[model samples]
Target chain A: MDTKAYIASGILELYVAGQLSEKENLEVAEYAETYPEIKKEISEIEAAVLALSEAAAPNKPLSFEAVKNRVELSEDTKLIPLNRGRNRWLPYVGWAASAALLAGLGYFYNQNNQLRSDIKLAETEIQALEEQIAGASDSLEKTTALLQTLRDKNVTVIPLGGQVAAPEAYAKAYWNETEKQLFIDAQGLPEPPDGMDYQVWSLTLNPLTPTSVGLLENFQTDENGVFALSNPNQSQAFGITLEPAGGSESPNLEQLYVLGTVSS
Target chain B: MQLEELVERFKQKDLRAFEQLYAMYARNICGAINTIVRDEVLAEEICQDVFVKVWEKSDAYNSSKGRFFTWVLNIARNAAIDELRSKSHKNQKLNLSADYFVGILERADDEPNGNVNTDRIIGFIKNLKQKCIELIDLIYFKGYSQKEVSESLDIPLGTVKTRNRNCISQLREHMKQN
Candidate 1:
């Protein structure tokens, strides 16, 4: 490419006038990009033309803002303040200070949140431990009162051996005559089947009469494995049987788990 | 090429970049329109609309097409010509013989300090031949294509670019001196 010859061709003038086709315009742009001298020539030509056009403009032409207002293509942005810094690097220094301040504020904000969450976690753990302690002390107090009742001298203890239904089961009955309360210690008893309860019976010797004692309700939840029932019928002997949820009309003798005699 | 960068950003709808471009070309575009329309107020009106149209049609412009000024100049010329075709412009023609824009500088001499742009611009064309003035007005201000200029001026088709080049060179020489 003879750059001087291309510059002398005057094709660049028409290019500035936009008289060329698309292909010619692209070719001119390519040459301008590649050749500095050609680009300079084009700029000079453009300046001369620009001057003529500017002279022909209205004496009181509208301001740039006025022309800008006629369009809504994101031209409504607020004017950014131009830098009024004294030194060349003042803006860079200001920006650095701002960024550092923002980072410091962010760090402290995160630290404050972390401390607050730690304090909350400690408070929650303390509350849960306090509830557990209250529950344990309440259970211990109930078990201690039951232990004291077992030692009362007016209460007679009867050992009941497992019947044919469960030969391995055993229990003790503490019969308090004054209180009419019979405490059954059923540590050796197997859990009752689903939808069933353990019913106690007070028996008479000759006629084999059976009187109802209260069922062991909530047998599954008794952690101490001991139950008490009211027995006022002068029970001669005692038997434990697995009956349906409500006590039966008579003991299902086939399911009797324990039998004991009340010693004189 | 900061101007190139600005034009690229302007095409991407960057309002700030477009502001720079509007400042750069708005006056020249209005002046060009005034030459065609020969009414300062009406030319300013058309010039405002032309920039808005330029923004709306920015996608139609890119570095690949031609000079950004040329694109804008083409738009202003069309808009000004369109206004002239309207019935209202028929009555507003200041001089039916005003075939060139140098008359603008002559008209500006009557104004006070507002004559600064035309004053300096008048110096550039002070030594220009009448043919130079007509060619400049037709090619740069009127956006006449090479073929259109040749046919209108009755010149051979091949001579338009060289003749335009001579006229613009004289403009550059005057611009350098002033």
Candidate 2:
């Protein structure tokens, strides 16, 4: 290719002025790259245009930083933060935080309820144990009193044999004549039927007269069937009979379960 | 060392390369804008805007397309022309015909600061034909292509290229002499 003829064509000048189309510009660019003379010619043309324009320029030139700052400011203004505005990523992060917080609160609430129930169960257990201790103490006091009565010098011990109503039922009574109190052990008796109770009576055997002393209401449920009854009458014997609900006005003779006598 | 290397670095978004490139052409760009806009302040402002645009659009530029200075010059010309066409400048003296590089020389000569030796410019211009002046003005300063110059100057289409070559050769000789 005649590089000089191409240079003389004034295309390089138009190329520098950006008047050439893309293909022509690329051709010129290739030519300029390949040939140093072509390159120098293009540069000289650019320099002439530059000098012309510079002479036409105002006396003072602008600072490059000022222009760069404007560029930077424009970029800063245009850049939206990832979290700002209606970003696609923002909703996902927000939902994730909300879900995590909800789960945490739910877990804490469940734990709180479980702890509360545990405390309630513990309180109930403590109440039940307290009741058991009180009952045991009361039973111990009753047994000690009964032992003192049996060891008393003026007390007479009598054995009661089972009668026709329950032939296997037996009982024992300790009479403290000075104190007018009788302590009966009816542990050998069977449980009375529902709505029925066992009543003990002080009796005079010669006249066959009976006086009601006390009724054992909770016969089956009582762990120890030791009962303390007042026997103020001059009793020669004691009788136990099964009576109807709320205890009978007089003992049903047919229901007599045991009988015992105390000698003077 | 070469202008190609600087332009290549500029394309790669090298700030230092861009600064060097700006220093090389900023005065020319301001001169070109001042020629058209005729207001130094407005020309400087537009010149800065043009350079910034060149930096931003550097990627769009390819040596295959044109010279980097040509690209920057095109930007300055378009910006100045756009400013002239804007609504605000509509009422201001509409001397669209006088919007040329020669107009700058004329305006400068009229100014107090234009004491700088314009004899070189005047002597160079004195030898050129009036048609050459209009052709150079349209094709170079106003960024008109050959066909537009032909149509605007009512000349033969083939004459625009040859005539422009001669005119530029004369200008280059004058520049060398100065």
Top-scoring candidate (lDDT): 1
- lDDT by residue (A143-260, candidate 1, tens digit) is 8888888888899999999989999999999899889989998888998999998999999988899988989888888888888888898888999999999879999999999999
lDDT of 2 by residue, B99-152 (tens): 456766766656646435453565566567777777777887788878888888
Tally clashes: model 2.
2
Question: Scoring each candidate complex against the real one, what DockQ results?
Answer: 0.54, 0.46
Best-fitting candidate, measured by TM-score? 2
Residue B53 local lDDT, model 2: 88
What fraction of native interface contacts is shared by candidate 1? 0.85
**Model 2 agreement with the true structure over A1-264: per-residue lDDT tens digits:** 898898888788788778888999888888877999998998787766665666677865468898778767665556865435557677898999999999999999999999999999999999999999898888888778778778999888999999988899999988888999888889888888888888999999887999998897677766677777888889899999999878878899999999988876
| Model 2 misplaced regions, further than 4 Å | A1-5, A33-40, A67-200, A211-227, A230-264, B8-17, B56-61, B79-98, B114-119, B122-130, B176-178
CAPRI grade of model 2: acceptable
The TM-score obtained by model 2 is: 0.62
Q: Model 2 interface RMSD, in angstroms?
A: 2.0
TM-score of chain B of each: 0.88, 0.86
Model 1, residue B42: distance off in Å is 0.6
